[model samples]
Target chain A: MDPSQVEIPPLKDLTIENITENVHLINSRCPNPRLKYLMKSLVKHVHDFARETRLSTDEWMAAIQFLTQVGQICTDVRQEFILLSDVIGLSLLVDSIDHPKPASSTEGTVLGPFHTHDAMTESNGGTLSHDPDGEPCLVICTVKDTSGKPIPGAKIDIWETDSKGFYDVQYAGRQEPDGRAVMQSDDEGNFWFNAIVPVPYPIPHDGPIGKLLKLLKRHPYRPSHMHFMFDKPGYDHLITALYLRGDPYETSDAVFGVKESLIVDLKTVTPKQAKEYGVAEGCRLLTYDFVLVSDEEARSLREKEAMTAMEKLGLRMKLLDGLPVPDVD
Target chain B: MDPSQVEIPPLKDLTIENITENVHLINSRCPNPRLKYLMKSLVKHVHDFARETRLSTDEWMAAIQFLTQVGQICTDVRQEFILLSDVIGLSLLVDSIDHPKPASSTEGTVLGPFHTHDAMTESNGGTLSHDPDGEPCLVICTVKDTSGKPIPGAKIDIWETDSKGFYDVQYAGRQEPDGRAVMQSDDEGNFWFNAIVPVPYPIPHDGPIGKLLKLLKRHPYRPSHMHFMFDKPGYDHLITALYLRGDPYETSDAVFGVKESLIVDLKTVTPKQAKEYGVAEGCRLLTYDFVLVSDEEARSLREKEAMTAMEKLGLRMKLLDGLPVPDVD
Candidate 1:
């Protein structure tokens, strides 16, 4: 059929139809070759969603307002909107989709929202948990290859919430990086630290994400967990967190970061066993091991680790480096 | 290669191959199909954009901060982020791509950030310029079918700025509804109104978008233009704006609402012709006619119009109606 021969409708009859056609055109214009297909697909889906929903003028305006608020609440230190992604499961989903760990190793989990780039590194056996008030516990882990060979000189980056589930940064002045630490495994790939058994606690509920969850009748609790990242030469880097067995929210963490493989049983050890590790007996002791893949795998793992870390914390790209970044995503 | 024989990388190794792979899996778990796709696509492009730009942590964080401010300045009555969209050309591109008016008709333009839901309707020759303080001018437009037949009872929604480029809403005391009126064309497909010649003006610069322009060393001026929406039963609706023949920023409108076909000369008419139109001699006059396509073609046009409106206004589906709205085009 000739293009001109197609009978064109008048303006009054065209409001709905024009929207459909225009979306297709816009999809064709994206400059990023890699993103063009994805962006076009997204635009198609988004336009379809709008049409299917029969969105109204007032409602559309409201969405604009909501997003604006999301942007507004973000700051140098606060990323309520990123927290919104966590609660909505988008952040975790993105992490999992982007970084599929091998089925054999410990599963990774949400990075939570409190990671700081300025975490101070410590020597082997250094304890991150500075508070002496919480229940005393010892965490022991080994870094090794898939074949069970030890990975000597591995750096074990560790952090965790206090017994009450608060990060050191959450109480900058009052808390001195309590329950948070970075330590290196010994030449034998063994690492140990003392801290309190973290308790399940609610995520910050004073922001828009919290408000949205409240409106949706959802909880904001994350299961008790400890964060660990292992990196060494000739092996894949691993950034993961271990959840405590049997926390109330273990099965339903708000951020969906819990994995059965990452759960460890905290055994109550006697003083004799604690003395062998230079700690008192009757303290909680948890043992786990992280197995790394080859060096190529480690590089890929690092990218995945970084992306997850950034997404979970709602840390914008600007915080990664002081430069202007586009808001495409 | 046999699928089973393919060597599967260890969980740690997999992390190094592609960060997006991890994100893809999590996206699969999203309950909402739309959100699933959105999250997956967003992460992919965001990561890709970052990698392409070699984005650093600080730059990414700054982008987040910028977005946060965009949200902060937004309110029930004001949307600075939408203004951000307008300045970025994304809104116009989205709208034009979504709603491609037939090449023969007057191309649609940006709806702008100042549109209100309620513009008072008036009869033929009704005055919309409530304030008489600005320069005296007359606007005459004919609404016709493809064959040049007049379309009676056609609605013409008209709005523009005063000589100082101020809309009625900009000044609470000077005028109730300055330079804004909605009227229906007469039986002969003709409509006329008395108003002031609009001048070029700068958008509000106290918000985040303003800050962005300052950082980029760009200006925020929009050329003089008039808004129009023509609708009649059994025909398509035409939403557009016409630019003055030679406004300073006509070639580079901040919102990108200008189009060649929509630019018109505002002729200074003789006293006799002015008297015939009930205006004084030496008054500026703008005469133009809007030609609309049939219903089918107009549907495509309206979709584009809506998309453009959505983009220019920083509109989101959440604001629309709690239902998914397609924004692809």
Candidate 2:
């Protein structure tokens, strides 16, 4: 291309058809290959989304303000942006893409805003919930490899909402965390904890994401479930949940975190059986097993997916060259 | 659609193919038509962008964090999100879509972040610049309707950078505004002001937008221009600029706000001519005319465009229904 012959296409009088193409070409000289690709793709999609909706100036301004409010509301303890991501299903999608299951391992779920570190290590069968107005329940689980070998001393970080459906952080007065504990599997690869049965709860509705949910007439309920993070040396850390089988929102969880393999049944135990476990009469008991994948396998799977993704991106880039500009008149 | 025969499709264990569909169905109960359409379309495009990019979990989180920073950086006087919008061309696109131009009228441009109300009214041919080191220039303009009729009493709000290419905002110590004034047209529809010829300058490069431009290997210089807002009783308010011809960045404005029709030539004045404006010998002069469209015509054009946009969106919705879930495998 001769410098004297260079055609300076007027970018000022833009029409709908050429806007995306011009945006795509604007930052073609970005230094980092990945960042450039991401930025270009972002410009294309965001611009197309607006054009596809014929988004008015008023609507665009409203979105900008909403995002500002969401950002302003975030603090160290609260992340409205993450909540926005989760509610929009982006969180779960990213999780699935990064962690492809090998058919035998525990499925991934969304790490909701309620998750907090509880370093208090509890002995097997110890209580986690301290709320008086809670129904007693026993959680029993074994950590094992995909081949069914016992993985003793695996640390299990667990949390759940109280029976009334509120996390410890949501309470006004409590300082110490409740309904949360960290326990390790015994020599037999068994871990058990006494706690109140978790119940479905509405996410915080005072913020921008909640307002958007309200506008969508969408319920913000996450199904009754116990949050669990299982980790041990030389193994992949698994973030998952044990959702109650019959919970009303089991299939309609607002964050789309439910998986068929993660849903477990609860059985009612007699008072005599409960006494042996040092729990109250008619306590519910849930028993399940978690299968961990090896860290090597997880890494390999991620690499495979990344390669496939690059190939797909390559294909999309070709189509970007002959982009169709729809007639605006 | 009998209740007894209602089938419950499993929402659990969703693959990439079905996730977007599930999100589309998640809020089927939204009562507002436009909100529903916007939300559904947003889900489709956002999801598609992620899939097309094969976005990693880390990349998605980084985007969320970047957006949060953009939001947090905004204050009453600063808006980083709007800056982001301008740099990405969304702001200009929205402005163009909302304010379509008639064939005989002046074009619109982005209302940049430097815009502020200049309540200090000045008579024709008064000085607007106060910097002692500034070069002298004369600005003369006439406000007229599309039919070439002079529009008396039309208010022209003008602002420009100093000779060194800094707005009053770029100065840290000044409280009183400089380089801006509101002047009314005379009975013959003429407005003139004495000021320095504006120089090209980089936008605030200390923010996230600046960092992004650096990473993209892009320059942040806006072409030298005078910001003008013309308003009258029954006419559409026109926000435009008189960009200097042959300016280095005229064709490559950082914000893509330059239009060929808005670019005007500057003529160097003789010392005798400069004496008439009480300016230096090497001062410049620019003469231009702005044609405004009636409010009613602007409204009719917007309505026609709205109908066309709806038809386009309707067609896109049909394509979304048969959305080709590409073979990601």
Candidate 3:
């Protein structure tokens, strides 16, 4: 079909069909095929959403103002857009799609905004907390291949909130990292650390996202969980969090990061049992195993999934010289 | 069904169905019924868009960064978020939906970023341009209601870029408004002004929006047009523009503001005819009529359309005390 032969609809008669067609025509000039496809889909959905909701001019202006405020309040220390995504569940949906792990491998969750490099490296079985007023807890976990074989020299990075549910970064006067540590697994792929039991806490809501939560009448609490990142040579990195079972927000984590496999039971120990771990009596212990996938397998799976997605969108590349260029760089 | 009896899907098994369900549950507590309904629909469309596009994590991060940059660049002098909305065809969509005029009424277009509140008040036939390099042009128009009765004393506010495609605001060293004036219609609803013809120019592309245009391989040009706003006490205000026919970007306006009825002929006048309009010999002339709508009729139509929309969205209010509260505030 000739482009010039197309009948352009008048703006006054601006139906949904006209908006979609006009958007597609303007975006056709996009040199990047992937970007073009995304733009078309974004326009279609945005226009349809407006039509479906019969959004008034006031509502649209309100949205413009809300988005602007979200952007204005964002800084190096805070990301309101990411928080918005988290609350709407878009971040988790993207994560799940990007990291479609095999059944045997550990599942990934949101990479919360609190992560920082330069966590102090601790020896095996060292305590990670310095708070004297908090209840002591011990975590014993193993890192291994999908087949359950021990993987030596694996790096286990761990971080969690204190008993009062505040990450060290959340404190305005903090100068040093607390409740965060990195340790290498023993020869048997085992590592243990002592820390305070994390309590449920609301995400910071003093900004626009918080105001939005208030308007939406939604609570802002995330389930208590310990963040972890496990890595080794020739294996895909695992960025995940382990949630404590029976936490008040476990079923409705504000960030939507809770998974059945990631939720673990916290076993309470008596005074004698606590001494064995060199902590006070009645401390809690958590044990779990993380299964990692090989790098080669992970890459292959991602490529396959991407190809299937492109095909579904009718965006398969045109063949040149009996081969097709990948839509993704 | 009881709320507690609802099954909560694990985040790891977060299908599209699960995300939709979670969003509805989280937003259930919104006090405002209309806002609650709108939130549910917004969440549904946003999630569907992400899923349909099979959006990658990198793409999501890129979007967040883009929005942040647009916001950070905004100031008292510039509005980057509004520019983004314009480029995506959203600003036009909102305007078209909000201002559904009668068949006999004039159409409305974009109120671009260059509008200023301080246009000088000029006599009905006074010249508006101070630029010596521009070709003098004559504009004779009339304002009336849909019943075809002249609206005496109606204020017609007009502004446009000079022939060089620069609004007075676009110049950094200017202290006075040029090529803009406010003229009231005579007893016969007739008004005329002397100004320079507008020229097509690119929308400002020196910011993130500019970078986006380059990435998309799309030009940033708007069709040459004259802006006008008509206001009267008992009629709905009309904000609109008249595009010159044969401009290169008329069919592909960057801001999506062009309409069939808005495109007008720019007749080049002979030396003898120019003497009649009291302009230079080779100046151009444009004549058009704008029909306004009664405020009462416009409000009635808006209320009816809004009700139909709410009914379509299944958002009707439950009756209490033999009366139902309207969905709109």
Error of 1 at B100 (Å): 2.4
Per-prediction CA RMSD (Å): 11.1, 6.8, 5.6
Q: Is the docking of candidate 3 incorrect, acceptable, medium or high quality?
A: acceptable
Error of 3 at A21 (Å): 1.5
Give candidate 1 regions above 4 Å deviation.
A1-63, A72-78, A84-112, A115-196, A199-223, A227-269, A272-281, A286-329, B1-25, B28-40, B130-133, B145-156, B166-177, B230-237, B293-295, B300-329
Can you write out model 1's per-residue Cα lDDT over A24-86, one digit (the tens) per residue?
Answer: 343333344323433334444444444444443344455566677677666544677667656
lDDT of 3 by residue, A111-215 (tens): 776777768999877988887776788888898888889888988889888878888887887788888998999899889898877788888788888888778
The digit string of per-residue lDDT tens for model 2 on A1-329 reads 11123334445656666777777676775646667677777888788777666676778889989989998987655778889988888888877776677888888788777777754779997888887888888888898888889889998989888878988877777678889999999888899988888888887778998889878767777888999988898777788888999887787787889988999898877777687788767788888898888888776776566556646555433212212111124
Candidate 1 overall lDDT versus native? 0.63
DockQ of each: 0.11, 0.37, 0.38
How many Å off is the CA of B134 in candidate 1?
2.8
**Candidates, ranked, TM-score:** 2, 3, 1
How much lDDT does each candidate structure score?
0.63, 0.78, 0.77
How close to the true structure is residue B298 of candidate 1, measured as C-alpha lDDT? Answer: 62
Q: Candidate 2 on B125-147: residue-level lDDT in tens? A: 78889878877788878888989
The full ranking of all candidates by DockQ, starting with the best, is: 3, 2, 1
